[model samples]
Target: MPLPLYLLAVAVFAMGTSEFMLAGLLPDIAADLGVTVGSAGLLTSAFAAGMVVGAPLMAGLARNRPGRSSLAAFLLVFLAAHVLGAVTGSFPVLVASRVVAALSNAGFLAVALTTAVPLVPADRRGRALAVLLSGTTAAMVAGVPAGAALGTILGWRATFWAVVVLCLPAVVGILGGIPAQPAPRGPAGGPALRTELAQLRRVRLVLVMLLGALVNAATFGGLTFLAPVVTGTAGLDQWWVPAVLVIFGVGSFAGVSIAGRLSDRRPGLVLAVGGPALLIGWLALAVLAGEPVALLVLVFVQGLLSFALGGTLITRVLYEAAGAPTMAGSYATAALNVGAVVGPLIAAATLGVVAGHRGPLWAGAALVAVALLVALPCRQVFASRSGVPTGPAR
Candidate 1:
């Protein structure tokens, strides 16, 4: 709840907006750049690819740097990339800009995750993560939709400009609000990268992050193809898509709120209850994509369960990775981006060829089912570590 945490959230909001708003701007981008819409869609893939590569690389490179300075530099690069993308007439240049922006976004997120945990009490680490991640959910509910609307009125370039403008205050806040000195568990004085990577071999940390990847694979895979399911399969009007997405967003926000309050105390309980419920929810969606009423109701419920599970896994990552302060954030960031890339590929492969509109739902269900299987024996792992360590890192 500190000002620094909120400032980090503000920066995350801008980055999250840039990440998801392209969903709505793709057609316009393709038209303006004289490329096929399918080609412009590659920009999204480029961003995810950048994130996957950047998260660990950037986090490792800046592991011992001043947090505030690192954050400011990342924000500056992100803003500059957006500016370049907005003005560029060449699609290749625009793609390059997206890649650059994604790298900046990944670095900021990797550092921010580690930065947030130390800003609060050990017991409140989950809450701190929620505060930072709320920016992402808020982007889904407001920023992405708003960007799409702006694109409608002012063109896609405006959305890029908006991201640049929005990030300016965050750069200032990083330079001012956040302290130059590291937090108690800060990575500034943490072990070398080799030693940090050793902590990743901790079985619990490995399992938790792997679970995070699978959970996100399910959710992101389903979400990436949801708009089509809504309009094409569920027989809804195009206008209804936004409303359905908003419902999901509202549920996602609620999920994160609940996780913030409960994850620190009852993460095991959440993982036990919510994880299976998420799998069931995805399975149900896979079976009922054609039923509009079912689709409408389930989307919100799915969002709630998926993200509740997500937050718990993230907390577990922090707790289990207690020995790896330097690389912990990158570990979490890479898992999510890995899922972001793999999920859609799984869903897209199933689309039309296998499950038609229901492919993504099936893909999601399969991923969660695998996650549950992975977690079944890992109950012992959760039993071992319950909260973030209050003492030194590991």
Candidate 2:
């Protein structure tokens, strides 16, 4: 609802593009740097690893810093990493750049979410967060594809340069738009890492984090192998892959928009509905992959439930960890990345035993079923805490 939130979204867009564009540029980077394509693919893994490790580390490091200052610093470092990668053209340097960029990206996101939530009314935090996260969905829909096309035309280095350029406006926005908000303080009147860690230990918070991981694992496990499923199972032409992806992206955007509006008042309801909805979607995909029309429709529904569940889960975590906003946000990022890494491994293993393209779908469905079981008990947690809703102190 505020201008600063949009700026935060811009920051996420740049970071997300950097995270995903590597997928399209790996072949080019491998050829140019004289490395194997598989080696270049490691850059993506390195970025994910950085996000998983760096988020909590950076959050702790910046725990005492003002939100605006820390966010600006993170973006500057992110921009510098891209510039170095673009100019150096060395494979090792490029790999290092991705790690640095991912670290900074994690820091920016954790800080930005912490920053944005306090800027709005308590009831509006869900919408504010949704608006901020929509930037990533936008990146998936537009930024990655555009970067890929740009890499194809002007070379992959140029795409890095473009990311650098895209980051500049966000930096300026952080400086000019966001007011200085001091880091959150404990009851003792200073930032307390111990207190935050204690809050993180709560069973409610732990369950929420695990729930987030399961949701992501379910979605990405299948999504990672989407292209093959589209062609091999659905009997679609190669050209249909991108179109189907676009459809899924559109569904994701719609999901976020709907979930954002409802999460503030009915987060539990959203989760209850979305989690089961996702289970059904995955099960449908497992059975319907051979039917092209059914497969396409289910893919779109899966994307919708994936992101809708994601937003609701984040809202739940933020609520449950209301005592430690910064660390809570970092924990959320770490949980999601854990799923991102583990999901594909699970899918790959399932494919080894399962006979066809449906393995991923079956794997995803099983994960979602587990997530639903985990989610069922959470209603009591929310009920116990309902009297004192956790939100920013105005």
Candidate 3:
């Protein structure tokens, strides 16, 4: 609720837009570069790979420092990457710029969540994280739409330029808006990073984080291939694809907002309902490919239910980690990156090997089922600790 938090959200919004806008612009980038769209799609893969490596690398380097200034520096790095991406002439150079952007992107988010955790009271940690994570959803709702429109009119590179332009004022906002806060000191006696990593080794915590990863994989595995799935299989108009995605984005934002409220009361119940609903949504798409309206409805439902699990899993992991919030946040960011990478690879193998788009939907359903099993154990953990603390991870 603080001004600083809002500024942080704006930066996240920009980053989210830049990261996701590539999905809609793949064709444009491919056409301009004279490459296959699938090859151009490596921009997303490159970004995810960077995040997988960057989250820990950047967070570890920034550890034990005042995170505010470090976060600002990372944002500057993110801004520069986008600017270079806009101007780069060669495809490989553009890909490299995206990788740079991804590193900054992952680092910025990990740092932001670490800074954000201690900003509010302990009782509100789940809500705070939900608020922070909402920026990603808001990016889908607002940034993706805006970027897609810009790319359509001015070219894909122009959208990257637009993100670069936004980052300048965002930097100004960060300087003027956010309050200076020191890094978190460890509880009682300080623990070394090795101790912190050891604390996170608890099986329950690891399971919850892996569950989060699987849920993310399922959602994105199907989603990354969504536009093509609808156009090629559902026989929908190409121009209408972005509109469908916008609807899904709206659903995602709505789910994220609702999940925050639900986590406070019945985290387990939310997952129970959401997990099954997600399975149903995917099934509807697999069976109803010819019905575009039906498919879009399923997409909306899928987004709504798939993301409903996010807050619950994040809350559970932070709670389970107990004494390593920054490390936990860093690792949580890493788990998410793992999911992001897995989603695309899973989709690619299924669709590519099978030579059909339906593979992603089927594979996504199976992934969700695995998440569902993981959720059962999560429910038992929460149920047994009905009056447990839901404080920040540390």
lDDT of 3 by residue, 177-278 (tens): 777655544443245667767966687878878888898888777777776777788887666667777877788888877777776567777777888888
> What does candidate 2's lDDT look like per residue over 16-95, in tens digits?
78876664565578889999654665676677678888888998888777888899999999999999999986888888
lDDT comparison, 1 vs 2, better candidate: 1
My TM-score estimates for the predictions, one after another, are 0.91, 0.86, 0.92
lDDT of each: 0.81, 0.78, 0.75
Candidate 1 RMSD to the real structure: 2.8
* lDDT of candidate model 3 versus the reference: 0.75
Segments of candidate 1 deviating more than 4 angstroms: 26-41, 89-92, 182-188, 388-394
Q: What's the residue-level lDDT of 114 in candidate 2?
A: 74
* TM-score top scorer: 3
Ranking by lDDT: 1, 2, 3
Which candidate would rank higher by TM-score, 1 or 3?
3
